[model samples]
Target: MNCLRSILAAGLASLVLFPAPVRAQKTGEAPGVQGSKNIRSMKEIRDEGVVKQRWDVSCGAAALSTLLTYDFKDDTPETSIVVWLLHRVDAKRVRSRGGFSLLDLKHFSEARGYHAEAFSGMSIEDLALEKTSVIVPIREKGFDHFVVVKGFVAGHVILGDPGFGNVTMRVDRFQTLWKDGIVFVVHPPDDRMIGEKRLPVAARLVPDESLISRKIGVTAPSNYLY
Candidate 1:
């Protein structure tokens, strides 16, 4: 009965995360054409030793820790960070059911050098968070899960899934999984951590270069593979 209840709880979480499938956007262009230009790929950063969640129901904390350590390197154990985040969220069910309330997440992230928000829809520019990570809710393995989106490539959003190390999915397919379009985005701080530097590569801005009136610059993650 305990096992059954756990399974049922997870099932409910899945429905809440991805309520329904969304129709794919009809774009006449090829997938390659839809890929963003001049953005750092998640592969690059994941290779640089991002922290993984150490607990089963600590996906929310793990994803947040990854973003917190993305620009700044901290030797703190991920478990410790998870506890800190849970306290900030101030929810009792998070430890057992494994999720953060949108209000709690927004308040916690915003207080810690991030501009966090809950959004139903966003533009490509919005997804293009240079130094930040977007927490996306998805359904998998009969449960709802959180994945941190670190970068974009070939029209696909690269995710640092708490359950799966790293994965990529078509934007259209991603939207289907992101049912209800609820997303928590963490924007980077104005002053990046020490040793963070932008690459010299000039990227063609998405939505066209005319909007920005200048070529956008991208950064290359440090190449220290773990």
Candidate 2:
């Protein structure tokens, strides 16, 4: 009996000294709060395509940079745009007058071989049909700012804001802030050759002078904004 008690005690002591290993969480199992947080972070990163503005008055440049980089894949830095615009216009004047204008952005786009147009009195519904992204100026909290309107997603207007990384707004709220309904649309040079036959190297090298005379028309909007 004493020998039996000694064996039982040794077994209990071994158990106390060495507990069984715990099972690790499986890869297929739900990650709970951490997984949800990771998903939200990914969504934010996917939505933000625009480069954030470095200065307060650089939103216009930043917006244009976003379009060039994100839409056309130009990858032009925002500072390059600011420097280019400031070279043409007085830097102090720009700062005092509240930054660059739509006309300035239009000229910049043209210089980059892109056709740009500004239309007033356009509605959100009209914007919904645009094939490419557009830059819009809005008044919020008594301040004028520029943002790249990516498009509608699930009933919210997705914007690639220069000041803010990415933002979403309701249709009604966006309309109120949009006020004059001004929109600036930029068309890449390649868009003009959608269905056309390939041109000879010499012909392609020559700029399309006819583009200057091309009439601007609105077409059906597409689901993809950029």
What is the overall TM-score of model 2 with all chains considered together?
Answer: 0.66
Off by over 4 Å in 2: 1-47, 192-226
Worst 10 residues of 2 by lDDT: 1-10
Provide the global lDDT of candidate 2 against the true structure: 0.60
lDDT tens digits by residue: candidate 1, 17-47:
2122322445466766773344454234323
Please, what is the whole-model Cα lDDT of each candidate in the order they appear? 0.48, 0.60
Candidates in order, TM-scores: namely: 0.54, 0.66
Estimate the Cα RMSD of every predicted model relative to the unseen true structure. 16.5, 23.5
Point out where model 1 deviates above 4 Å: 1-49, 72-77, 85-92, 110-113, 123-125, 129-131, 140-142, 193-226
Instruction: Tell me the deviation in Å of residue 189 in model 1.
Output: 4.9
Candidate 1, pairs of clashing residues: 35-155
